[model samples]
Target chain A: MLYHPLVIFFIEQGVPVQTVLLLLMLPVVATLVAFFRQVVGIKAFGIYTPSLITFALLAFDPNGLKYGITIFVSVILVGMVTRFILNRFRLLYLPRVAITLSIVSLTILLILVTGGMYQRTGLASVSIFPLLIMITLAEKFVATQIEKGSRAAFILAAETLVISIVGYFLVSWQTLTVLILEYPWIILFTFVINFSLGKWTGLRITEYFRFRKIARHL
Target chain B: MFEFFKKSQGFLGMNSRNLEYIRPNNRKRGMEIADSKLLCKRILKKNNLGVSTLIAKIKNYEELDQFDFSTLPDSFALKPNRGFGGEGIIVVYARKKLARNTTDENKNNVWIKANGSTITAEDLKSHIRNIIDGSFSLSSVPDIAFFEERLKLLKLFKPYSYKGIPDIRIIIFNRVPVMAMLRLPTRASDGKANLQQGAIGVGIDLATGTTTTAILGKGHLIEYIPGTRLALSGIKIPYWKNILRMSIDAQSVSHLGFLGADIAIDRDRGPVILELNARPGLSIQLANSSGLKERLKRISGLKIKTTERGMRVGMNLFGGEIEEEIEEISGKRVIGSVEKIKLIGKDGREIEVEAKIDTGADSTSIDIELAKQLGFGDALKTFEEKVGGRDVLTELSKEEREKLFSSIPDLADTVPIKSSHGYSYRPIVLTTLIIDSIPIPAKVSCIDRSHLSYPVIIGRKHLRKFLIDINK
Candidate 1:
């Protein structure tokens, strides 16, 4: 099979193959998120959030999915603890979020230091960008908690994590990346699928659960 | 494929709502106007529609600093001009009265919120500062902070709503008012008429202006006012026609093809426009217990020119369905044309007998034999001896009728009823009727219903608390 001309040009220009592969895979991750939302009826914050979280997970050592999940769990735990402690202070909204993020950062630092001591280099030397992205997720969690109470916030955060993990598996599959590199035009199919998804008028799977009693009589 | 069809049914999904209705119908300019509360109110007021009076506005830190707290009204609502989802609204119930010999200048300006929380002048300044800094705006852009006159709650809704005024939300599509719901603030919602924040949404019937069903918090169906025995259904909203006319007028002027208009009834001002929404929520479907997709699709392309015509189209298309569904969602037990009723006889003795649930008759009638069995036999016998039968009863003059009625037993009265045959006088006796496990004291007339299949015929007088399902 002939290499796509743009891929060849990118390679000649000294662009990393991994970056190009990721750029092409972003749409695929987004399409998967849309499907989870419109069809499966998962409301994980908003569309951009779960997709970004998925990419952040993939960036945190693509081969070691368990490490990424562990870090994500720690970030959420730190965020929730900070919120529970800060709620008594009656602080303003922005400063409260800032304080929560600061606590999350310090906790992640401790996690890395402990990992380094244990010689788990993969956990110790995880990329800063991915860790930072995961930490930013705490803001959304805290905001939802403030607006809709902790129960709703926890459900949304859990759904986000679920969709992100599912997306992480889809994008990190070696076979798909190889196919995307060989035939980069496959990415355009996501747009077509998204167009059809946009036109979807059917009830979401969650809606069936929400309107179960109403649907029976109707 | 059939499974897929069953999954969707006729409900309106968010995707379909945006792509089919909002994208095509709601124009950009209209949405922009809807986004700004101050602008929307100004436009509605310019069109001669009723809106809450604006008390004051603080545009920036300079305006915030210069504003005088003592000059403000005892009660007003502080709100962000571009706030979304009813956020950043502080409704002041009243100004806190100052105690004698207390010299704290700040405490003089303290105001009580609807939730009974107190805010000092400095706290109010900071909250207004946050509003100017875009804390609650839809996009977090700088927004104007203004105070509006707090509307007095109507006497009818005092018990239904908690702390705040309840507003009616009407979803208008293609100028025809499609579906409507009444949002009441609860203690959990902090006295804001927003459904997502734990307020109760009661669905309103378009033709009759009566609430049919209600959903509390997110989407759990409720039948009564949280703690009270008052049924949420059957509440006939006053000024309903004016509420409809004003909402449609707001939609017409808004230029948004698909809209949600929130109208609140003031104690004296009547129906006034609270706000307008471009992208309304879908929880109203849960409250109504029906899908909005079918209703919207039915009137999608119909050319409705005038506001009156649009309202007429809406009521005609979606009106009568609630009459049937109300029985199911109203939390009342539905009985068939025939039911088993328990009669409480003399000295608390109970007897079970089949009764005909008649919606046609004004007063309940029972067989003379059954009345005698219930220990009302003395009263029946005395009335029969004095007034004779139906033929003799009708021939008596008014003076004679009054004299014969007084001579009957103290436990009985007489009623002149018009029947298919002609006019006749019937003896009425007081007894208790137990239907569907609820006890009701009723005035039932003694008649010769022995030829009828049922011994007791329940009339419309006692059927107010029940739903009659003929097919059952």
Candidate 2:
């Protein structure tokens, strides 16, 4: 197989080959998230959040799904609780969001220590970047909860989880990773797809469901 | 498979759209001009194109803070300069009545919408502040908030529009008006003529300037206006020729090869150009139930000289009278689903009967009872003797049939018709039909149509000289 020159250079420089492959895979994951949001019409919590969450999931070992879910649930719980408690104080917007982030960080720390006690080393070794991403997600969740009610926020959170899981599986596929590494030029196709997705003005698949009555006439 | 074929034939996919029309035809400068409503209005006004007059514009927060609200008229519209998709537009239809003894200092006018909802000055100011903050602009970029004269609803459109003024969106390409749809404000759209916000889009026929079909929200076909029995089709739009000319003119002046011109008819000023959209939406295709690709391909390479010539060419090419065009090419008059035809009898007696234009039938048929009333009973007797009954004709040899046909020189023609009961031979006779004020000779078969709605059915064979219009 003809390997990409950049991949050969990364191997020659003694860089972890899997890390180099993951770096190249980020745009592919981001493009997939965009497709889910744009063409497929899944209203997930923005493109970057799901993609980063998926990356954080795929970075872990065999127990990535378990660790990822634990982190997600803990952050949302702590953020919602902090927001509910702060509502009584009638504080300003910026300070309330700041406090929510701090609480979210503390909850992740608590999760890491509890996982250590339970002898789950995956949580103990969770990186800072993924923890920061979780904190950002918590902030967005709380903001959405305040702007649009709890139901809307929860629905958005569930959609985000669905998209992230889909992205995680796609990134973890062994054959796709190998093919992308061999044909680095395939990344250009992702760019083309993203460009076309940006220009898509047709009714989405979800819209077909919404307008099924009209489709029946057709 | 049918759905796929329909989509491929009529649907303009997003990729082909941007690559072929928008990105190539729309220049960056032209897009910027079309994006900013204030700038577009200025350019249009300078070119002597009629636009809603600008009353005032607040460029920044400082200007807004120093602005005086009382200087504005009773009815006006406030809009964001760079707004996209009809956002940040607050139209005040009228001012509420004030107390008799109220002085100028304590007047405090309240603006009311067509739905009878009122907005106080404080509420209006906050809305203006939101517009200035760029909440409704593309990408949330800071924008200018300006007030313009709100056009009075034209008498013809008052019944159709909820509270806001209705605008006609004409999509022009290569200086030809390709497709057009009238956007009517509905109660669901909150008196805004934005289709995405639930306005009604009625497709307008290019040639005759009459409405054909209407769609609500997106692509759902609606025959009548919601909560009313008023049919959406067949409404002749006023100042249609002028509207088409104005659309082509806007395209020429804006230098945008592909553009959508939104023109509103004022009660006094006739039709005025509202705005030019560089990236017009594709919902007009659904409104027209036709594809843009075919129309665009037809007018692609035509050498259009002036705006008048382009409008003429558009009306000639993409016009809605498919049947009329066929009639024009073949020197025939177009008839409708139902028409009144004057049947001249053998005794020169003329009687008018409503005939159903049936393209399914191969030969024109008249009721046997009506033929007797028309003094053609002897002709039927001769027809029966020559062709005999349906069974007898089926039993005849080919040469015998030819000899039988030659023997019947007095009979007009004979044809066997199949129905639910069985096959039956009908006698044909030559008669004169007065259709649409023109008299022509036609051979009609005599059949017992006592159970049918119309006494006479105009079939495809006799309808060769006329075109059938289903709408009519």
Candidate 3:
């Protein structure tokens, strides 16, 4: 079997609820958007790879919460190290994203391989391949650092992750899941929403900083 | 109906909708922000939270066309100060055609757009039409539209955003940030986060203060640039928690029951509160995807001391381990759509037998039958809803409503469905109707809910018009 029998068995059980899929996939999509549309200065990898990897592992061990935490922690640790490495090597941003993705992919691969050996499951090991996305991210981060400098690039990456995590939880939510599941196309409203925002030439709530003093002065 | 075909949306093993549940700890102290923008500004200024700058406020409709739309700055937003949503706001970038006020000899007096479109006289007239229709104010109480300066954009997001800067939507219950999402302006969004338009909603993780997910325009999930894959999960937001604190502070300042604080990031200025929304949007719920009703119910009785203290409590309460668990528990998430209800007279509320769900009625009205069933009907004589009934003859407050109601004689509080001849005023009774599951109860002006299309009109008289979902 591609995966351990148990992993396959879980799939057979139809274990992942619609809500679970919702939570798992949201961050990936959000991250993708922040990069392309908003041009948030984050990584730009092919969208499918990372998204698929994340979702496939969604039906992993029942201790999903713990596992998710562990993965996040690992990714962060890897991300920092990847940052230091790319910086030290002076890798360009796109290459840095690629290298970061490579390093992350390698680590995930090693872990999965060793894990497969321990569990006698081939597919389980390959399941972690989405690490390539991090590799892609590394490339983007490196490029951003080169172009926008470390601080701004880092800010972009940080916000991207923050938005993604938020997206993860939101998309993962049950009520949200059910609602969107029913009206998934409501996403189309995004077009109309963008139209509304297009007309919003007013000061942002955050603009109070520069404007507040002006407000006080006025 | 379309939702049924959503099954194939399962592309590459990911969830189609990003639905993050809000945890209990993240919820802040509850503050009932008043609906009045002028009132809210007074409170916000005293509390030091940011709100829109007001140039002047006109009270009636007579002075509408006479007011100088020209004396304003080259760039200013004409807004219905009390308007909720994005309605009734006229932002004049530059002047259009040569009016009588301009130099008569200067042959070409055409105002141009960033895109080079000429602003003709008819354009401004159409805008005025929206204003005259009371499109901006909360209620059609003829309001004055005022002008405010435009916010400058932050350098970091220049490329990503269109002409308009972006805003962050933070939902603070009490004083804590339960959930937050960044609303980015695109060519499609027209530079506004009003999801009713087409702006991108990027979910933010409270724990990390970074962007977690990105949604193009609305619900469709895309990864990378429309053509690229940019991992969107880690863009960090500056002064993250401070924004939550500001929204919460604004609540206390405004006394709004519930609020959606719109904050924006400016390069030199940092974070500012753009507008305080008493009734925010429902997309926040869809964006965050967790029901806020139950969470709001839990903290309904929280004893908050001050806005700052409440903010701190909200941070600690919602920031810790509980968030993840809440994400696991209810998966209730959404960014905005707020309403503040006063649950008084609910000291000993009774369980509702059969309630009607009507989006048509902005507010919820109880039937005299239900009010009596809940043990409060006799106390309702001079109340509002009861007076609408034909036989009740309750005193009327507004000459307009009275005139309107009198003319429609069929407009009884409780007209029987399929009743001909309009004699179907079941009975008008006054009592407090309890909110289905919420702690707040209205000393509801009621009527015989029986025989009406939906029992109670749940009229705007009752509901302050918070966008809602019965199932949620």
The weakest ten consecutive residues by lDDT in model 1 chain B span B385-394
Clashing pairs in 1: none
The DockQ value obtained for model 1 is 0.31
Q: Name model 2 segments beyond 4 Å from true.
A: A1-14, A30-50, A57-125, A134-164, A178-218, B100-106, B322-332, B335-472
What are the per-residue Cα lDDT tens digits for candidate 1 across B1-472?
4664574568887877888888988999899889999999899999999999999999999888889888888889999998877888888888998987988776689899866889888888888988997777754578899999988999999999998889999999988889999999998888888888899999998887889889997798999979889899988899887888888889889999899999999999999998899998999998888789989989988998898998899887877565555656896667789999999877777889999999998879899999889988888888777765465455877788778787777455677767766676788888999998989999888888878899999999999889887844
Docking outcome class, model 1:
acceptable
Give the whole-model CA lDDT for all candidates, comma-separated: 0.85, 0.80, 0.50
The DockQ leader among the candidates is: 1
- Give lDDT for model 1: 0.85
Q: lDDT order of candidates, best first? A: 1, 2, 3
Winning model by TM-score? 1
State candidate 3's TM-score: 0.39
**Winner on DockQ (1 vs 2):** 1
lDDT tens digits, residue span A4-66, model 1 = 788988988998887888899899989998999998889898988888888888877644468
- For residues B1-472, what per-residue lDDT tens digits would candidate 2 score against the true structure? 4574445444554545766789889998889889988888988889888999999999887988888887878899988898776766888877888867778742656888666789877777777777776666765567799999998889999899887888999999999999999999998887888887789999888987888778998677898999999999888899999999998988888988889999999999999998899988878877776677778888887888899999988887777564554677989787788999999978697889999989998767789888878888877766677555556445777687667766664467667667554565667788888887778788887878999999998877777777676866
